[model samples]
Target: MNAQELRDKTPDQLRDELANLKKEAFNLRFQQATGQLENPARLRSVRRDAARVKTILNEQAAKAAE
Candidate 1:
């Protein structure tokens, strides 16, 4: 997903997306630990997606506070 897509989502939706991303990241890490991870790049993408969701949430919060 991209920033524009995330920006269009409600905060609650974004939170849900973040939670899913975190879960995926955790699973990716587990697979890596077990030497079963097929695509190592997926772990990095999931981490970045989670960060993007977080940044958007923070931006919304700051906007609301203003």
Candidate 2:
């Protein structure tokens, strides 16, 4: 998912996405550790996506606090 799409989602949806991405990241790490990872690039993308979700969440929280 892109940042634009992420910006459109509610906090709840973003939280869910972040959780899923984190789980995927963990699994990817496990796969890599065992040399079973087919797409190492996926790990990078998932990590970045999770960060993007976090950024959006922080923005929302900042707005709410105002």
Candidate 3:
């Protein structure tokens, strides 16, 4: 997903997406270990997306706390 799409998600949705991304990253790692992964670049993309979700989530949380 693009940054715009990620930014459009609600906090709860972002959290859910983060969880799902992490799960996908784990599976991708497993696939790489077994030489089944087609595109290794996906790992980097997933990690970056996960980080973006987390950063947005944290920003929202901080705003709420203020």
Which candidate should be chosen as best, given lDDT against the real structure?
Answer: 1
State the C-alpha lDDT per candidate: 0.97, 0.96, 0.93
The collision pairs in model 2 are: none
Best-first order by TM-score: 1, 2, 3
Stretches of candidate 3 off by over 4 Å are none
Query: How far off is residue 29 in model 3, in Å?
Result: 0.2
Each model's TM-score, in the order given? 0.98, 0.97, 0.92
lDDT of 3 by residue, 20-65 (tens): 9999999999999999999999999999999999988888889999
Candidate 2 accuracy as TM-score = 0.97
Clashes of 2: 0
Pairs that collide, model 1: none
Worst 10-residue stretch by lDDT in candidate 3? 1-10
lDDT of 1 at 58: 100
Q: Report the lDDT of model 3 for residue 14.
A: 97
Top model by TM-score, which number?
A: 1
| Candidate 1 runs further than 4 Å off | none
